[model samples]
Target: MTSLSDLRRALAPQPGEAGTAGGSDRPPLVVALPEGRAASPRDLRGWETKAALAVGTSGSTGDPKVVLLSAAALVASAELTHARLGGPGTWLLALPTGHIAGVQVLVRSVVAGTEPGVMDLSTGFRASGFATAARAVLTRPGPHYTALVPTQLARLVATDGPGLAAIREFDAVLIGGAATPPSLLARARAAGVRVVTTYGMSETAGGCVYDGVPLDGVRLRLNDGRIEIAGPVLALGYQGGEPFGEWFRTGDLGRLTDGRLEVIGRADDVIISGGENVSPTEVERVLAAQPGVHEVCVVGVPDPEWGQAVAAAVVPTDPDTPPAEDDLAAAVRAAVGRCAAPKQVAYLPELPLKGPGKVDRAAVARTFG
Candidate 1:
């Protein structure tokens, strides 16, 4: 009858317990058995291994996989982050702890020897709720911090009161969970919110790249345009116990320019429309920046003439003044090319969210398919 709290401690490797891949003389660390329900961690059985945590991945795709994280990996991630973002500090837990992003908040707290101020996600996210939770976080010593999805940050910026003010005071606020629109980033920075866009997932122990720059000891490469990351912070492996090799190849498509990684979109998400490869993110970025658009998700749907057609699901800022389909399509055409223009547009109240507030591309595609 091990409670989740006790399991967390048993899984947390003690000092000096973490060593290089196969050279650690210490007995294997926690196996991190996963239970979606209450009271996890049963018999060690054949699961005993060198992993400290088990996390699940999130993407636009419906498929999600469990990733195994090592103590060294998590420690390296937190240490490198502290060095980059002005050292460890108090953190407000605004995300669900079941995900890697949420798990890292607690992990960073442990590394900093502080307790995190938890946000009541059971009641859904609200500016008032975040503001109240953030106030308590700032009361602690050291630089106050918090991580959130773009939706939460956008809401804070829109609210423009205690929530935005509280955000302005933090040393650094991490925004991840999905691709953040540049407009949103501009808006956040304009309000004096130190929003840092993070890239990585459960496979990388949360985010290994901060603001498009790889953290210390982390490396990035593009294989045939797909992102492959290698670093101390990389996850050990998946469940069933197959350890990763030198690098973990991600589904993300991106390029490196002057050592900075620029994530484009998912490689698998490329749309072949009328024999041209259309990047959904490129279209979405263009359409989202339009005046009336609040948020947008672009997906390729089945088309008779072109085999596949580019489509966009938009959330208009003003429901009464929804963006015109032609304007959005023209914008995309002007930016990327005609091949990237959306052939179909669906205006919605909000884009569908997958786990942890990421845009659910599959669902969006199904709606417009």
Candidate 2:
């Protein structure tokens, strides 16, 4: 495991050092490792030499790719985040260091010249453990900040214990790595949590859009319903792919409403059932609002009748008293459309997650198999 101090020293520019994407004397690429994994050197034959860090993609839909990020991009993201959240302060690391989200936490703390309180995720994230970490971070200074996935936020909110109370003390809590349910966001805000929804990926240096708005020096535009981002925060490119041009075409389908980005779903995630295109995100949104539904993942499953059928894997508020399958289907049918209603529903204690907060749709689809 690379220590936080090691990362900071590697990322920080030395005296008279030139840190740019075009710089000839670039530092060795630092690979972010997942929890419990030892660091190892990778074949860097075709990788971008100017990149400062190499973070792996979650591969929720396919095989993971290595994303190369430059020092300039990481610094820009951290500075913009601080400017957006009213200046940098102490930060807490609640995510795995292997992911871009966790790496950015360390980067921001390094930029702020502050030590971050790290959470022990070897045993997995728990509200009790988070509360303890939050207590230690809060004791340091003002304008405290932390980043988390929606799943972590949900746990803290559900616990309603010292965890939830501790979360309310932070100046900002950035939620990303997946689409957040509006109901969950509402509940967190109602409970006094300063939750800021973020939308970005490893290719964009973690998050370049905060609460639907692009960060400073970041530009966003929609092309044929697909989200395209261009800015300093953008990554150099995938390790083996061509360097990004003016715009990085994101796989997410989104639309801008009054200048704010509204992500619909993944471009490849749309389900075609009976010749009608149904967005799983829309169906999931409807199902999430239904009473007794805690978390839900809508996926397309192969069906003999409809060619493809909409299926939902739901994590109920109470495992013992899961929501009625027909009721959940009816909710989606009413809110989205009849064709969007889930034909199959599976109840679980929790939705299977890939990466940080993203639900594993492929696994959810497999549940119907």
> If scored against the real structure, what TM-score would every candidate get?
0.91, 0.95
**Candidate maximizing TM-score:** 2
Compute the lDDT of residue 340 as modeled in candidate 2: 100
Evaluated at residue 342, the lDDT of candidate 1 is 89
Taken over the whole model, the C-alpha lDDT of each candidate is 0.80, 0.87
Which candidate leads in lDDT?
A: 2
Q: Give the TM-score of candidate 2.
A: 0.95
Worst 10 residues of 1 by lDDT: 37-46
* Candidate 1 ranges with C-alpha deviation above 4 Å: 1-16, 19-48, 59-62
Candidate 2 structure quality by residue, lDDT tens digits, 1-369:
446765665576744555543244445567885543444344455437667788888888777887888788888899999999999899999998888999999999988999999988889889999989988899997689999999999999996798999999999999999999999999999999999999999999999889999998898899999999999898888776788888999999998988789899999999999999999999989998899989989999998899899999999998899999999888888888899999999998888888877888887788888
Tens-digit lDDT string for candidate 1 (1-87): 112353346345565564322223433333322235222242222323566665666534645566767777877888788889998
Please give the clash total of every predicted structure, in order: 0, 0
Q: Which ten residues in a row have the lowest lDDT in candidate 2?
A: 18-27
